[model samples]
Target: MAQKSEIEWTDATWNPVTGCTKIGPGCDHCYAERFAERWRGIPGHPYEQGFDLRVWPERLDQPKRWKKPRMIFVNSMSDLFHKEIPRKFIDQVFETMESAHWHVFQVLTKRSSLMRNYIRKRYSDRSVPSNIWLGVSVEDKPHASRIEHLKQINSPARFISFEPLLGPVGEIDLKDIAWAIVGGESGPQARPMAEEWVVEIRNLCERDEVEFFFKQWGGPRPKSGGRLLDGVEWNGFPWQMVPEPILERLAS
Candidate 1:
């Protein structure tokens, strides 16, 4: 867990679970995996074992320990709903988010069905907590089903990250989704993403009233192409979905 993060959208990162396996085209050049693997064999480092799925139960309470409120990206280093993560452990993560109600928790994952199922069972008897946001990461059209799975969830604070968007997502209905973040792949072997593809998604977001955030026009480095979309930066954020209490905290 970190008190601060460089990610433009969030204030901090909480990795109660660290490390993950690649599961989709979006994971092909995972920045998280690249970062974690770099510390492998360095004894005493948090990632000494590399990008292998490992849960840090001790870090579950990190959010609660912080007195001030912030936007916390949950499991930024791993997918919380990875098939190997036990339901009980997922329960622990949920419990922590509920307890640390002061902070907004952003949980993004590529394992859509698993995330949908877990949230279904956990919040079956009640509504999803407003402070906890659930989202999915998709690289192209094939994984668009992840967006559908997210729609099936109980939360109003649902979002999608089309980072490393490799191709057009085609026709999609973003009726209930609160936000969408789109960006091209970065790093040495980054794949190319078409402008028409991005504009299509942006137009869809415009029609559906979903907040659209264009992260970057990624190249060899994340900022290599800068973050301009049609000569303007799209920095949309879903503040309306943020709970009133937290909104008040941020306002103060």
Candidate 2:
């Protein structure tokens, strides 16, 4: 069975791989890491190893088994393109996604270059499957370059996550992007997010005709500050990128 998710954008989570090492500031107070570590030493717990990188071949076909069509967040607990994961395992993951064409798979990663390279090599002779949406996480202005990497990919379903928005992401282009989700960091030590910073990105998304979603104004908890931006909630989604069959089912 698929693990239901609380994330606003997706319906469920699929983690064939679990646990990850931080790669940037966005990962500093990772919610996944914190959640996994809590079960570190509990016998028979899924996270007994406590955020240590591990691959579960058994979980590879979870999506295929779920007959109902739904949006699945791929590897919510870990980055599928993390350096330590074997290329063979990554291949298996992609194979499952490609075969499970009934669902939309949201694959996000901080290793932008790796994801770009892998996608290029895997789909060199064809386009990426529309069901597989690729994205990169950018925490600040410096990491905005990841967007450039994402733009190079050949998929029309590309998106970005600016969650844990640590600092302003200055002027950046969102051309050819399908969607963007922005939010402040949450947790015990959540950092504050500025209104101007979010407005800047929302304006950019509008200018580029990209979908904009304001996830939260995060604080001690995800809902502490409420998600209203200028007295409204932004729940933009790229429906055009979803496959026709999936779209029909979702709408039904």
Per-model TM-score on C-alpha atoms: 0.98, 0.99
Over 4 Å off, model 2: none
Model 2 CA lDDT for position 193: 94
> What's the true lDDT of residue 212 in model 2?
98
Residue 18, model 1: lDDT of 86
Highest-lDDT candidate? 2
Top-TM-score candidate index = 2
Model 1, span 1-252: residue lDDT tens: 575987888999999888998887889899999999999999999999899989888898888889788999998899999988888899999998999998999999999999999899989999899999999988888999999999999989999999989999999999999999999999999998889999999999999999999999899999999999999999999999888889899889
Q: Give the TM-score of candidate 2.
A: 0.99
**Residue range 27-129, candidate 2, lDDT tens digits:** 9999999999999999988999999999999999899899999899999999999999999999999999999999999999999999999999999999999
C-alpha lDDT of residue 113 in model 2: 97
